[model samples]
Target chain A: MRVSLFALILVSGITFTTAQEKDELPALDNPHNYIKLLAQDAALPALQGEEKFILRESWWSGRMEPGKAKLIQVQLFRRNAYQFWLAVPNRNGEPIINVYDSEGNLIPSESLNFEGTNIVSTMIQPEITGVYYIRVSLKTTIESPQDWAVIYAYR
Target chain B: MTRFFLFLAVSVLSSQWGLAQEAPVKIDLEDPNLVFVSDSVIPIPLEIFASLDKMGAQDWGRQIESRDIRLDANRSRTAMLFGLVVSEGFIGVQAQDKESVRRLGRDVLALARSLGVSAEVEEHANAIVNGAGRGEWEMVRQELDKTRQTVINKMKELRDDELVALVSLGGWLGGTEALASVLRDNYSAEGSDLLNQPELIKQLKLDFNGLPKRARRGDLFTQVSQTLEHLESLMRSDDTGAISEGKVIEISLATRNLVEAIYES
Candidate 1:
């Protein structure tokens, strides 16, 4: 099965290098590529809108266990609107993404979830500028771990 | 686990209902197990630069300072200086100073050459020059960002993770220094709030600590460490508090001195 998967990846013109020691699932090596693509796709609606949003070059990616959440801290400035995209490629689960202020208060944001894709996004224009935490989690009945990637854009 | 799920469901529903209209759901900020994923990638300088513009920061030309960019023998210092030069390029673009942007483009090329990644960035450097000459400030900004990212990616390909961190740190320090200067000149509670970045400072401190012994043994490194410590203290807030104007001035001076040291000393 591993060989067949490798062959399929090669046939699809996707590069697969040896997995990093920290990664538990070798089969999901380079899963970031899949999730990144999905995240970009999810960002299309906002990008095509009248507002000019520059997609950041940096991104966050990691694996999460079922029912657990991953938190990422970001420094956001006031007056600049930001949209965060979270993608779990080829996963059968609902991904939840939320933004919170340093004081643990949840910031109100517009959440976008595509009907047929495992990509979710949230847009927020922070009232005050500071460190905002983005929490990502997958709601799934399966016990298997999931790989997730988050990319954000700001205007 | 069930309890966590219940909490998650509640949090989702509350968020969906608009937290402002509903009672805000507070998370356990004191949970020891709640580890934030260590962000390996520091933000690019342009993000902060954009914020400065939105905050009614004017006279960007005054923020553009002439720096001595003589090649350093230390690879780490060179990489850092390279990052600073790219940041200055962004400032030049912001100020619409074409000559400054062109000179910075040349400096970026020289530094990239010193770091042995000139081949990777020469095209971007050339494009920056051409774009500046044409007075295409936006194109120049994009080119500058490309030049910095190209160098970082090349350094990573060469397995120079330490250089990568220094490059990012260099750019960040330059950006923060410029921000503090602008904020000091035109103090606003709203603008000062931007400096509340203790978590980012802590992450950069970890980067400094993670540097190899040889890389960390220098006056420049020492000053950077001290500045990081000072900034962390000033920026740290136990509660949601705005950074004060006096603190902004202190931050400005600290970052300016450190930036000068990075470039000169």
Candidate 2:
């Protein structure tokens, strides 16, 4: 049997299938089965199941010394898919955190507030199975003024 | 063993892919009068001084023409304190060297003029510093008594009793020097006369005219301006505090001292 999976937008503003829908869908009924299909939407490479494997960490003790950025990278993948997310915590004042992608591409960084700290999390949705990488650094301010965030990801 | 490697490979591959990876999302966080929205989804208090006003709609028409040069009271206070410290700490002359003392005296006069202190004190302070550096000790000693009374009169408009105590202590601490080397160059007669004179403590009470501390907190543009204007004329003060600077340092000093002493003791 074939059924059309309509996009019933969730109220949480995140446009991905929730747990309930994932359970009911026969396409994913077998946990042992992996998906291989045509390009449903080529532009939508993110197939709407990320943030699940996001690493979880409890503490960032703020031992960040001068001239440093707390770098964080979260990578997710399946057999034929690769996904990546990278972000640096905003440390306000004169310093800031810089973010870089797997290909060593530079992205803009941000500043933290007066308390002089910030945290960011990465959630990547995989479309094709491939390996991914992330690089993070400080774009502005003194170096190493922050501590590394606890990496929280699903085992 | 193959299956275990497969499982490990799959798990490693999964970890590397970030399976749930999605494009970054950002909410249009609007702050009407936000000061430093430096972090988080949380809202912080507004610094409400510049182009942003909480009450009115953001007039984009005027915004293009407008500048954020509304001179935040915070910036003014910070800048003023910096200026005050520079003036007091770095600009004054000691009896270290003849040429150096003359240079410092010149610099102090320039700073006083630029900072807009009254001309009388400026000139008197200049003459004394210069004369003492020149070994014209009598002229230096006379100006000391004059500056003492001048600064004392300047403090009278203060409503802050605590601040008055601070200024009093500062005056007394500054007193020993003012009579010795400082006054010796300006006023030798009153130099020894008021060295540790208990009567000189009366200058602490000179600050009775400024409004109560609480009244000084709000819309200083309205309150501080009007009150300072009235008090300036009453005290015969210069137009230094005429601008609605929320921080009147001289006024704050009297209150700051007493509060510090209280807190410390």
Total backbone collisions for each predicted model: 0, 56
Question: What are the RMSDs of all candidates, in order?
Answer: 7.8, 29.0
Which digits, one per residue and each the tens of the lDDT, describe model 2 over residues B81-181?
22222222211222223443344345434433432344645766677667756766434433443443343334333332333233333333222222123
Model 1 lDDT tens row, B151-226: 8878878999899889988998888888789889888776777788887899889998898988877888899899
Q: Is the docking of candidate 1 incorrect, acceptable, medium or high quality?
A: acceptable
Best by lDDT: 1
Q: State, as a TM-score between 0 and 1, how close model 1 is to the true structure.
A: 0.82
Q: Go through the candidates in order and give each one's DockQ.
A: 0.35, 0.01
> Which parts of model 1 have CA positions greater than 4 angstroms off?
A1-29, B1-24, B236-240
Tell me the tens digit of each residue's lDDT in model 1 across A43-152: 75676667778777678889888678778988887778998988886557677888889888788887776645477788899887677888887775656777889999
Model 2, position A131, has a per-residue lDDT of 17
Q: Best candidate per DockQ, number? A: 1
For every candidate, what share of the true interface contacts is present?
0.47, 0.00
